[model samples]
Structure formats: structure tokens, C-alpha cells
Target: MIKIGVLIPEQYKLLSVAAILEVFEAANKFQFASELKETFDITLLTINNQVDSFFKTYKTDTINTEEKFELILIPSFTTNDIKNTIALNRAYIPWLIKQYNSAAEIATFCTGAFLLGATGLLDGKAATTHVDACAAFSAAFPSVQLKADKTVTQDGRLFTSGGATSTFHLLLYLLQIHCGKDLAIKTAKIFAIDMDRHNQSYFSSFQPLRHHNDEIVACAQEKIELNYQDISTIEEMIKDIPSSRRNIVRRFKQVIGITPIEYLQQTRIEAAKKLLEQTAQQMTEVIYNSGYNDPKAFRKIFRKTVGMTPSQYRDKFQAR
Candidate 1:
């Protein structure tokens, strides 16, 4: 039996915990029906080893820390403040590091990556979290490679999932790795989860980091967002700024986490998405309006950024 540890941090997102447990519970049922000898043994772990009281909405259970687990799952937290959340749960860091050292695979759901990253184990590894928190995550953990476009990322034994619903995808991935593809598919069908779903790019929006106190970079970002349709917007921005083009580009990248040209392209693609979803515009019109004159170029960039073609996006999300 594979022992799975579900870490129940204080003020955790109850739904994420419940959903994951349900997936495993359903998998157990399937295993029983199939007369499979192997099954998962799940345990609820807490920081204080005392889960005496419920968190108002959900009940919490305590587990013995003496037992070793093959996998440790950290569920998302209800708090938006990553630093505060991490600080509140500082007691778990040493335990988590010990678990990792003992060969336990760590998996984080949504913003739980912040807590996982806090352990210093994710350094030099590719991981992902919720889309909206990508900038903050990147800023906070510079050593970790943040793959915001991916719904799920796994480096070695470390695993992470994007956003709330993407937790199901990560669980399915874990199921496939542990129990095989047949069991994973059976579990996915039981949960009605789409097994083919992979990338989180389709639902992600272009959220540039503007919280940094860089007035010039902020101005450059504003200019790009306002006039992304203009092909020479980058040059115009460079000329309008007081610093040299190279310096401005460097500062923009340092502050905004993306280059000026890349920002411009993302801004344009975001605009194109809005048009495709909200307006009855043709593909050519979307290309031109998004600031790209060439259909091929626009389509290529759109696919690269959004993980789908213009028509596919429109068909999937066109306002009915």
C-alpha cells in the first residue's frame, strides 16, 4: 500500500482537501471492485499533531508523525497573503524538509507552492502555482523556475498545480504515476475530470507586474497596453523614456518580469482574446486590431501565448 500524507494546515482551503480525498476514496472503491491488491493508505497530517477542533466548515484529523509517507500533499490556503500564510505555518518547514530528505515526494496545490518553496527544496526546479500569483511567486522565489503557463509541473519528485480546479489534474497525474494509466483514467471518469486537459494558458490573462516602484517602467507598460496595436509602440516608448533604450529594456525586464517587446506581444494577444470572446470580429480583424498586420504572425503568437489557435479559442469561448 502507498502511504499518502495530506497536510492540513490551519485555514486551509477546505474544498481542495475534500476534493483530493474524494478522488482517492473513489480510487479505493475502484481498486476494491477490480480486486486489486494494491491501494493507497491516506493519512491526515497536522503541524501541531493536534487536530482536536474543526475549522468551522470542515473537520480536521490528526496523524502520527512517526510513520513515513511516500507522498506529501499540501493543499491551498484560504489566505491570499503568501508571506503571512508562510509565517503562520513556519513550524512545518523543518518537518517538510525532513520528509523530503527521507525520500517523500512533495506536491503543492495552488498557492501552496509558496509554502513548499519556503522549504528551499524547490530551488532550481520547475514549478507552477495559481496564474494570478505567478508574478508574486516569481518575485518571492527567484531561484525557482515558475512555469505559469502549465496547469501542472513536475520536476523530479516535486509536483505543483495551477489554481484551484487544476488540483484535480495534478491528482490524476499522481494517480497515473502510482497506479498506472488504466486506474488514472478510471479515477478521472469517476470524477468527470477531463484527462486530456493540460495547459493553463487558455484561462490565464496577461497580468503584468506593476506593483514595483519603477515610474519609468510603469509608464512604458502603460504605453504598451494603450497602443499595442501600433507596430512601432516599442520604439515610441523607447524614445519617450528618459533613459537609453538598452537601459530602459533592462529596467523594464527587471521590474516587469518580461521584456518590452514580449510585453507588447502579450498585450496585443490579450486584446485579441477579448475581441474573439466578446465581439463578432473576423480573424483578420482581430489580427489587425491586436496590432499585428500579418495573419500568420498573429496566429503563431496567439497559439504560443494562449496554447490554441484563434479559431479554436473563438469556438471554445465565443460569447454565445
Candidate 2:
């Protein structure tokens, strides 16, 4: 049996924790119905051996402190204050690190990536969390390669999934790895979850990083947001700001996590998205309003950044 340890953190998203357990239980039920031996030896591992959700209390079997689990599952957190949440769960980090050192695979769902990253096992590894938390995650764990666009990321023994529902995708992926593709598909069908999702970009709102305390970069960001359509070049932006071009570029990257040009592109794309959703603008008009003259270039960037073409996005999200 594959020994799996589910870490129950205090004040976690109850649904996420429940969903994971239910999925595994369903998988086991299927195995039992087929007269097959049980495949998962599941244990609820926690710091105190008891956890309280927003709605109820749970007490379950815990892992022996010295025992090594084959797999450890970290559930999504309920709170937006991830810094506080991580600090509250700080005690789990050393335990997780020890498990990883003992050759255990670790998987995290949504903001659980924050906790997983806290273990330092995700350093130098590719991982992802909720789309909105990407900036904070990147800022917090600068060494971990945050795959902001990916819905699921697996780096050897470490795994992470984007946002709420994407947790099911990660679970399905793990099921496939441990059980089989057939069983994974069966489980997905049972749960009515799409098994083919791979990108979170389609659902991500392009909120630029603005909270970093760089006054010059903040001013430049405001300029970009206010005049993205009128503005044409980094040189023009530099002329408007007091900083040198290199300093602006360096500071912008440091604070914004993207180059000035990339930020401008994202801002323009966001504008274009609004126009596409709220107005019956022609593609040419949208492109021009988004500060781009080339239809080809606009389409390419739109598809790359939004995970769909402009027309497809319009069809999917246009105002009713």
C-alpha cells in the first residue's frame, strides 16, 4: 500500500481537506468493489492530532513523529493572510523537511504551496499556487520557481496546484501516478471534474504587482496604468520619470516582477480584455485601443497571456 499522510493544518479550507479525503476514499471504494487489495494506507497527520475547521472539529489518526510517509498532502489554507498562516504552521516545516529528506513526495493544493514552500523543499523547484497569490508567493519564496501560468506543477517529489478547483487536477494526477490512468479517469468521472485542465492563465486576473515599496517604480506603474494607450516606449516613460533608463528598468523588475515593457503589455492586454468583454468592438479597434497597431502581434500576445484567442475570450466572457 502507498502510505499517504494528509496534514491537517489549523484553520484550513474545510472543503479542500474534505475533497481530498473523499476522492481517496472513493478510489479505495472502487478498488474494494473490484475485489482488489486496498492501495492507500491513508493517515490524517497533524501537529496536535486534532484540528478545528470553520464548521466542525476533526480528530484523526496521526503519523508517528519519527515515521516517514511515502507521500504527504498539504491542504489549501482558508485565510488570505498567508504570512500569518505560514507562521502559525511553522512547526510543520521541519517535519516536512525531514519527510522530504526521507524520500517522501510532497503535494500541495492552492495556498498550501505556501506551507510547502516554507519547508524549503520547493527551493530551486517549479511550483504554483492560486493565481492571485503568485505575486506574494514569488515575493516570499524568491528561490522557488513559481509557475504562475501552470495549473499543475510537478518537480520530482514536489507537486503543487493552482487555485481551488485545480486541487482536483492535482489529486487526479497523483491518482494516475499511483493507481493507473483508467482508475484516475474513473475517479475524475465520479467527481465530474475535467481531467485535461493544465493552465490557470485563462482564469487569472492580470493584477500587476503594485504593493512592493518602490516609490519610483510605483510612479512608473501609475504612469503605465494611466497612459498605457498613449505611451509608446520605455524611453518616453523614462523621460517622464526622474530615474535613468537602466535604474528604472532594474527597479521596475525588482519591485514589479516583470520588465516595464512586459507590464505595459499586460496593462494593455487587461484593457483589451475589458473592451472585448464590455463592448462589441472590432478586433482592429480593440488592438488599436490596447496600444498595439499590429493585429498579428496582439493576437499572439493575447493567446499567450490569456490562454485563448481574442475571439474565443470574447465568446467565453463577453457581457450577456
Candidate 3:
């Protein structure tokens, strides 16, 4: 059985908390138990037994540390909002770190990544969170490598995700890994979500980076993400680098296996994907906002890379 625990504290983000509940609800309603057996189990844990407005209370003795959960999920809320529970809330940091040290695969959604970060389990892992918290998270835990792209990231035993509904992607990914693709597809269909919507599952190897040297590549990657709207030409990119354009291009291709331009396009497309999933922006607005000045070119490239037009992609992920 795959034991899944949702560590809920006081004053959690409604959407982040809801995402986990909804995924399990979908799993139960979509017949995952009939097909997958007792493979997926969801348990809610808190610091105390008292009920809060954010979630219903479950009995404290219901969870056993020896039960061996395969996954522990933490949802996001303000760090200061956990309320003043000495046993339930305050015990979270130490208890979570202990849980992480066990055999279970640990994960978090949005700022929930902060809880994992506080535990120091992600000190040397690659993870992601909502973009707004990236800089603060980086500064707080300099050892963890944080990426802002896509919804989910897995580094060894740890998995972290970004955006609000990315938690759904995270749960679906676990379902696929533990149960199978067929079960995952079934649950996704029941939710009216597209199975093909961003197929980069957590366990898959990411595409190669474009720069050979870690420092240079990280710098260049950061620049691309930060200045996606302002970047225009290869020469402009080279101007930001201390090395010559020829050397940077050579190193980037050697390390990342793609040209700078290609990486930039991928970045913009990724940005567009997030916007389409999260907002109601028009196609033209998404194109321009993602740094594509020419809407026609954006459409062609988006189609070529994603195998769907921008509108088609948007329609696929937007709530049914």
C-alpha cells in the first residue's frame, strides 16, 4: 500500500490544501481503489487535535509512524499563520524531518516547499516552488537548488512543485508511478483534466542544459528566466556574459545540448503554459507577455514544439 499523509497546519492556503484533497477525491471516485487496490491511502496529520476553519479534524491516534507511508505531502500556508499550537504546529519541523528520513518519498506544494526546506532534507536537492517565493527560498536555504519551471521536480527522495494546481500534477505523477499510467489517465479523465497536459513526469531525466560550466549556466539560466521579456538577440545575451559570445555559445551547446535561442524559446513557451493554466489572458496577450513579439511566429513555434496550437493547449488545461 502507498500511504500518503497530508500534513495540514492552521491557516493553510485554501487552494493548496484543496488540491491534495481533490486529487484523492478524484482517485476514490474514479475507481482507483477497485483497480489499484489499496495502493493509494490518504491520511491527514496536524500538530493538534483541534478543528480549524481550513480543514476537518481527524483523531490524533489515527496515524502511526510505523505504518510506513510511501509519501508525505505538505501544503502551503504563511509561515507565521500556523497558530500557536505547541504540540501539533510546533512539532512539525522535527517530526517532518524524521518522517523524511524514513523510507517514504517526501513532497510539498507551492510554499509548502518551505516546510521541507526548513527540515533540511532538500539541502542538496533540486526543487521548485511558486515563482514569487524563489528568491526568498534561495536566500533562506542556499544549499537547495530551486528551479522555477514547470509544476513538479523530483530529486531523489524529495519532490516539490510550483503554482497552485501543480499539486494535481504531483498527485497524478505519484499515481502513474505507483499504480500505472492507465490508472493515472482514469483519474485525470474523471477530473476532466487532459492526460497529455505537460507530460514531463517527476522521475524522468530533464533535458540537458545549454552551458557546460555550472556557474555560467546557472547565471545564464537565471538571466533568461528574469529577462524573458527584455531579451531580444544573441548579441544582447552575450553582452551580459563575461566570456565571448562564441565561447558561451559553444559551452552552452556542449552542456545543455541546445542553443541559447532554443532555450529562450522553451522558456517563453513554458511561461506561456503557466499563464494559460493559471489566468484568463487572451492568446495575443499570452504571446506578448511571454516575450514573443510576433504572434504568428509564436503560434508556429508553439505548435511545432508542443504538438498543439496555443488555444488548444489552453483549452486542454483550463477547468472544465
Q: Pick the candidate with the highest lDDT.
A: 2
Q: For model 1, what is the error of residue 117's alpha carbon versus the real structure, in angstroms, after optimal superposition?
A: 1.7
Lowest lDDT 10-mer window, candidate 3? 199-208
lDDT of 3 by residue, 1-320 (tens): 56778876755676777778777767665565476455556777765545455555432322335555678888887553222322234567777777667777888887788777877889888998865556456766889987755578899888888756677788788778876787788877776665544432221212334334567766777787788888977777767678877877887775665678887887888788788778998888899999998988999988766656778877877665
In candidate 1, how many Å is residue 244 off? 3.1
| Local accuracy of candidate 2 as per-residue lDDT tens digits, 1-320 | 88898888876887888888889988999999999987888777777776555424333555447777899999999997899999998888888888888999999999999999887888999999999889889999999998998999999999999998999999999999999999999999999999988988878778876567788999999888888988889997777788899999998988778899999998999999999999999889999999998899999999999998999999989989
Model 2 spans > 4 angstroms off: 53-64
Alpha-carbon RMSD, each predicted model: 2.7, 2.3, 9.3
Between candidates 2 and 3, the TM-score winner = 2
After best superposition, candidate 1 residue 18: deviation in angstroms?
1.6
Better of 1 and 3 by lDDT: 1
| Pairs with backbone N, CA or C atoms under 3 Å apart (clashes), candidate 1 | none
Error of 3 at 112 (Å): 0.2
lDDT of 1 at 136: 84
Clashing pairs in 2: none
Better of 1 and 2 by TM-score: 2
Candidate 3 runs further than 4 Å off = 31-36, 53-67, 78-90, 195-320
